[model samples]
Target: MDEPARRGRLPLPHRGIAFGGDYNPEQWPRETWAQDARLMREAGVDLVAVNVFGWAEIERSPGVYSFEELDSVMDLLHEHGIAVNLGTGTSTPPPWLTTAHPEVLPVTREGETVSPGGRQAWCPSSPVVREHALRLVRATAERYGDHPALALWHVSNELGCHNALCYCDESASAFRRWLERRYGTADALNAAWGTSFWSQRYGSFDEVLPPRLTASAENPTQLLDFRRFSSDELLEWYRAEAQVLRASTTTPVTTNFMVTAHIDTQDYWSWAPDMDVVANDHYLDHRLDDPWAELAFAADATRGLAGGAPWMLMEASHGAVNWQPRNLAKAPGELERMVLTHVARGADAVCFFQWRASRAGAERFHSALLPHAGTDSEQWRATLRLGALLDALDEVVGTRPTSDVAVVFDWQAWWAVDAGGHPTQDVRYLDEVHAMHAALRRAGVGVDVVSPDTDLSGYRLVVVPTLYLVSDEAARSVERFVVGGGHLLVTYFSGIVDENDHVRLGGYPGAFREVLGARSDEFFPLDDGESVALDDGGVGRVWTERLEPRGATVRARFTDGPVAGGAAVTRHEHGRGAAWYVATRLGTGGRDALVTDVLEGAGVRPVLPGAGGDVDVVRRDGDAGSYLFVVNHGDDAFVARAPGVDLVTGRRADAHEVPAGGVAVVREQPTGRRRPSEEAPA
Candidate 1:
């Protein structure tokens, strides 16, 4: 409920869209540093992130430090006129520190200590690690605070990327302290965690422990609280380092957030306020059925974390990433398309994981701006082309993306909904969320993925997908939005539990049952690879429920299932607006149809009214003027009906033809007039 501490924005120098990536000169010889800077300038790069993993290099042992190499690198970069996004070099601990204090190592849920070969092996709750890491941060900030090349302060590489949750004794002690702060008394904690359920009551905070490996399912509420505590612990570590940096430098500070689909550790909605400027590292995971859709979802979610302000694509790959099961390289023009997609959503800077390919390391195969083949390679040429593209679109720097629809996504709910005690393993939190987002994208609409606590008045349509754990305040907010003449669509398994993971006793979806004018007494979870038929010629899968509609109209019913002839979908005209509920997991076509109907009722239209599903469109407005970004992902070329100068091609066109796997940025004419396009519809 309290206001979070605010830091200033990123202090960019000679700002256009800051174009560069992670540059590690420490990995190469002394002579290669000059060549890296030369090639950086040649590619129109004005910013480079350095020393992301420099702790081992800077502090070889306790009370001893080295800075000659870092100093020369900084001076060389400054001489080249390229600004530096300096890292505090505390992402990982050195061999000496871990060797001396092995107690700081993180422990697994099964009581196994994680060794220190990999990065981020230190426990987040360990005071020894914090003491050592902050010492490095203070030294780095004091050394480079006044450096002319320093443009921004990067806190750490990626917090919680590896060591999010630690079940060690230190973590248990920190968890107990955090619980005491949250609940004030043991009795209150017991009531909130429902300790009476399994004789898990605690008389004092010291009696509590982390949710370790158990015979059966652990206490669901305890598990949920552990996640919250783990996230807060990491955040506290970040704040400690940030405080050290602020004491020395006025430079804006931030850490790259891993906001991709796979990571669900830290609650970024709570972490967003601590940032001077929100930045994220995203990679295209080839394993997903729709990797492009996932990329769009991540970018939109990052924009949401920024509260619609422009953000930075801090670390994307130039081509392939080494982490996935099958590392597939980017196709021709795919990299450019992906970069422009982020820009369209609200990114002012485009950066990658590393500047040059490493000859030795775990990530040697990972793509880079300058590959092993040097400047003659296709990846290098594409990188040069991307730099040129970013140069021409300099006017779009601070513009923000606007959206009329929002998808409610909560990290607590994500943690609770999947915490091992649910009715069925078939229903997943992200699957429903991503399905909703993908459907909206296919409808050619721009969506903002926001938390439940975000203001819903700005959006015309708010979709809540599988938000199983919601607080009373958040539920009331959704109700107020609907009563204030806003449209709402809620999927199954949502509003079933409160903030403390306590079930709402009266009905299945107790929070919004009154607003939906429907109540289900029981749930009918389908078997694996099972589906039921809907009366409207649609199919339902995964879940179904026995519904009793009171003061609501049944729009669709299940034809054949355990809850046959039950209300599959219902709509209620609750104040000046309507609330729709889906009691069953609908198929793609069914879900799309329902979403289309809801959008039609809400009077929400897409940015490009007639654009195809493969063509994504986003509009950003600022002092520079309104810019429409059209990215075509389909096989055939698509004609975007916007009359203005194409920033990418530098030619004025009545209507821009965006080739397949290409992007088009149109600075619209002031008159807001569009020339008729003779081409057929895409």
Candidate 2:
């Protein structure tokens, strides 16, 4: 593929993790801009994300659009030598558009209509919404298409609006178009929705109703279909703007997604294909965040998606934000350590929310390179330390993560689980996915988190927990991988349904019966706090469906219970590989043990082991060799026995371990085609 085939590239200035932060000059004066630039120079900040929330100022009330202020800001930034992550600034609706067309008002889940009160408050499904958003996108691209100061395009602002989407008129129509394309016929729709059961079969397209909270969700399939519709609708929205940038501009494009919060916004699997590079926002309430578990998997998953493409730490914090109860300052060197973790995981650049904190707005209390207290604050000092580090290692920005072993998780499946209103409300995909991730780290496995749609043949093994929707295509990909001797592990709920959210009624595991070897007839739900003990005596909440397997050998089953004999876990062999299934939500111990068994069965391990549980390990897949990131997330001393050159010191590990809360990036031996430089990120 040519560079800028779909998403353009943010030409790399160098390597070793780009250091930068979001710069909202619209929030402050030009004098503050110089000071911000000075602080950035001190912190080694190289890129600034401009125009994320500037729609009101840039296109002041439609026809009266003016870029004079933005022109000056861009000119000054160019003079400062800081590359720019340009934004189209379509997140918040400019008051003029909303006031003129109130139909763009976003609808709530319960049908509680909203008046635009905050950023991202506009309806995504509204035609008027899409129309205006596109105008801004096109306008921005036309005006700044080949600006020399540009680094990349940060399309829309943070992208997800807490999953509250447009339930307005236009979205409903768009949802129908998507359904028509996917199902082809009303009969197919009826079958997919099992509409006959509820006497809800539609006679015509117009009769097709949305799965609103008050409407279609009466059936599980209805709810699932709605979830699919909503996600696809948003995907279309992102794609439309992406198409705009791809057609009119030379810069790579991406919108920042919130880190694995509700529904995995900018979910790498769903959205990465559209990104020139991936960018995400990461923040926590200070006290403690299992940085490795929660954020690492998200990052690895994204890196894996763009086929190991480079990504940026688009947004981070200079200090604690106003949201947390204790807006604690990031003590001294805390910022540097956090940035290192992101780089070790595979971030090409780093930037905070505000270049300088908002002087007087909602985010006035938010952390930034420059703060409300002005020039000489503790937060400002931390920014300086970060800048110094970025300056020292200016050669590795816009680099990719080199990895192996793509762990398969799917949004379709995730959506199914969520909308299925699973018999158990406690079934959590992120938690289960994280458990496996934690186990891989413990065993020192170079883990690459991925989705079912992601390419699997590159890795030796692919593990998918509760792959409820193994679309035929995704199933074929897995089959092809296994046929070629790649390992496959598919857990309970392996098949269940198809892409349209319809159950695979012929038997269980609709699409993957042969590959997984398990046929589930009926599985009963187990409520929270209740569990079937593993054969090893470890117990946990049996989140959903007690398994009844046929053809597959039981690996683990609910012990000491009425459903004890039912297959709670099973394994089967196919072609040159094997697949396994877990029927219950095992506690951490059981989950870890189960994952260990699977990885061991696949014959994969981290190049270096025995670094202890606190050292979070991840492998970034790239061209010639991969970069292994070993992060010490625990409180005690974490001794990381480095596998290759410690990228941090340009030296190998002298001792067999690193100190507590330390990190190491090791170079993995090369294999396969040297990955070519591509515009899109993994």
Candidate 3:
């Protein structure tokens, strides 16, 4: 168990599953508050997040505060037995404050001042903005310190969602200070940033600035460091507010983290430690042809971010989100399936972006638990149905799930691999990461998308999917994990760069070359719709490499490409375990074949063997017992072969039978009592 779990659980005042979302009573009239609360109770909601974007309503002017409106909402929720995840309301500053001090606003890279119409316009590095935000946080903590309804202290909503990279003078000064602290001297900074080229050497820290428009593209190292500094600056603001809130009350502090690959500004790996409860806000990609797969991948990634402990799905959509390019409502049963997916992975609490829909605002069209169509709508009914389902799955709380396979997804790699000047602009980090994760899901193999720094003691197989930035520490960790008898799969474009975005000299696959038992001479980036034949009757595309195996057995070789007859894949025995290197992007069939061979070699089996065709299965172990969550995402019926009582139906079945778009939660027998043949049915 993690420290948080070992100590105690959070989202307090209620046990079981937490089922409510952001409640903006400020948007509705005084009379509507009671109706919302009553409806929340009817829907089995025990928690409601409040005061998130209420800075304008709470504090009118400098140091002038009014909590009359907020007090009424809190009292009403308390009267209705709903706990509150009290927010500090520091996401956006009031219009009066912005008008009084325009310096508080951020400046873009083009040096344009941000206006006050949007949320998160204030610069995190600005002293004035920090001071005002801290003031509001202090006031909020003081008012709700001992309130009956206060459950958790939500520190500033989504810290760097908008102003992650501000090029304002205030940010520039802060960045310089951060660089000075990181590098200690200008000469050190110059050397780290490779400033000798293009006559960019800095004589003093003040000479450095946030990466902005130059005559040409900015220096890659400088841009990388600037992003690091900006992320830290925002983190510093979160820590400051969190410190004040902690001093005022014993409530747990958390800020919603955007845990997706698209938002790369803030590295949540570094920020995850500061939060008492790891809370994430995930939105389905409407652009994706298969969003549920992405959701499953994201939930597993979020669970890994929480150190395999239970986390909170702080914000998700009940139906269509307003920000996607093409907003589409959830198909019948998608809402339930989405929520259940998170819970099956490791979410102890499930909450949405809002409870009631907005009438007039930027997010007025955003779907909520209570839509604009009123309580009679399908959305509201779905919310009620989900709430009842959660009420029955109370035994799932505090449980931890273990995965035999892990996909290494590092932020450093995500930042550095996609850095400008790569061999091909088509080098997408998430594409490769998701390919491995999606394959695992399709095969019914439970997978965990974890950071490179995470401990690999639990997993039997670790797949490094195009991790470009392999720090010496991370490299050694992987080596140790493999040497300790763990199976590892490394892909192309990996282990090429160091933490500073500097390529490791000597050969490609830098620090990992020794363990991988292979080295690359050059990159053969194929053109669009082009492919290379492999010796194993498979084809590789997008990228290929001139590989020479060293003290390893060649698994496959290129047949007809620039690197013809070269090693396309190699497997090497390193100590007690094995390391496999994939030198190119193998087609889907090739990847599936390769993954299946690796799983067989590693003695790993899927949660549901041969329960194919979009039937996703995962298991979680807890004090209650083991739980097998089998969900069918296909159009056909699936008969789960796992043996246990179906918790959703509260009945013992010989085999759980679920129809199309159905779910089954089975409580299995204890591990020791189970027969050997019944161990994760093969």
Candidate 4:
């Protein structure tokens, strides 16, 4: 449990599945505030995040604070029976502060200073930025600490959304200080970074610098450490602000984590422990091959960060977002399906980016609960419908979803595996992770995405994908998990490097070679659009390896390619459980087949065994009973065989018909047997 949770400062202390979004009254006229509050009540909104980017509006000049408008906004929200998730308004620095202390501006890798026109333009490691931001936090907390509307203290908008990495002189100095604390001595830092390579050894921590723009690929360890340092610097800044908030009020404090597909700078596993309640901002990126699958993966990952506790869906889009190339609006019923999906995955609160659309700003076209078209619009209607559904399923407030399968996700591995100098750039960290997760989803299995260091004793099956970097302790824990009766499926390019970005030197996949009962000496990265045939009639792409199994039995072999007749996939019985290894990127069919086989061996079944791949079924258990959420993301409806009262429709039936691109929540009865199947309409 986090500090606030331990101190009984539970987030949303008196709410049931809170519903609302970022409400920026500052952006509207004072006359519109009352109307907004009225509409909020009509929409069933009980919570609103206020002043996310109000640093400049609150603190016009240095230390000169104004809370009259904010005071009115809070009072209005309280009067309307809505709670406030108050932001410290330090997301962006005022133009005056940036102009006066231009040194606090973040410098890019190319030595270009990020201008103050955008949010989060200040360097996280700069003392000037930290001091001013904390002052703002203190002042905000002091004024509104005892306010009735203050339910939670939102630290900064998104901690490292824009300025995660800064290459300025102040950042360099801070990085050295962080290094001294991490490695203790320059000699240790030299050894860990392998600074002897290419005559780049550092004599002291002072000589170390952030991995700046280099001619060729910079030192991989240096790049890895710089990424680590950058994440830590931002986390330190969050801690500083959170400390100020904690001193003022008993309200729980948290910041929205960017746990989406694109943003990867912050190591959220490290940041999760500091938050009172884990909240994530997930925006679907349509650019991916499988955006919905990625959404499921991200939600599972966020639940893992929350330690299986119910979390908050801090920011999502009602329809469309301004960012992303060719921003597209959500199809009819997509908003409800997406929101219910998050709720089913254990998000107690469902909120969007903003309550009202921005008429003029960088994200002017971004979707909101109340779009420019207002209440008559499809977006607003859908928002109101979702709010009602949330209110109906209020029984799911403190419940958690359970999953028997676990996927190991490490940000350090993500940083190191995707760094320069890898054999094939095609082996992306999330690609393999998402592919594995999608395969499981297709098999109708629930998944929990956890860090490499997480406990694996409770899981029946554990999947590791492209984990190129891992510490010895984490590797040993995984080994223990396999040896002590936990099924494991490891994919290509995993277990290659140590924590210091150094290869284990004996063989490829050096960390788990013994446990996997396999050894690989070489890699054969295929060309673009290249695929190799497997002996079992499955196709592999992007990567292939020369493998020799010692104790493991070959399940499939490469029939053609540079490494013909080699083991394409192998399985070994090591102690109490079995370990499977895939030496190449298997296509969807092959990966799904392999995953199904592993789940069968481990005796792990999906929430609804025979449900179609497009139908997602998840169950949450609470005092109210088990709530089975069936989401059909296909063109046809799905009939789920479970006896319960449908929360959405208020009907009690043995089987619920989840419509196409729709959702159904069933509060299950205790006396019915569930026959998991997807029966099409006659």
Top candidate, metric lDDT: 1
Tens-place lDDT per residue, model 2, 392-472, is 544444445554466777765676676645556666566566666666666666567776766677776687777777678
lDDT of 2: 0.68
Q: How accurate is candidate 4 locally (lDDT)?
A: 0.88
lDDT of each: 0.89, 0.68, 0.86, 0.88
Give the 10-residue window scoring lowest on summed lDDT in candidate 2. 673-682
What lDDT is obtained when candidate 3 is compared to the true structure? 0.86
RMSD of each: 3.3, 4.4, 2.1, 3.1
Question: Predictions ranked by lDDT, top down?
Answer: 1, 4, 3, 2
Please provide TM-scores, in order, for all candidate models, with all chains considered together: 0.97, 0.88, 0.97, 0.97
Q: lDDT of candidate 1?
A: 0.89
Clashes (backbone N, CA, C under 3 Å), per candidate, total 0, 35, 0, 0
TM-score of 1: 0.97
Candidate 2 runs further than 4 Å off: 1-10, 14-16, 162-164, 215-217, 243-248, 264-270, 285-291, 323-334, 395-400, 506-513, 543-553, 565-567, 619-628, 643-653, 666-682
- Writing each residue's lDDT as its tens digit, candidate 4 over 530-564 gives 99999888999999999999899999999999899
Q: For model 1, which pairs clash? A: none
Q: Which is superior by lDDT, 2 or 3?
A: 3
Worst 10 residues of 4 by lDDT: 673-682
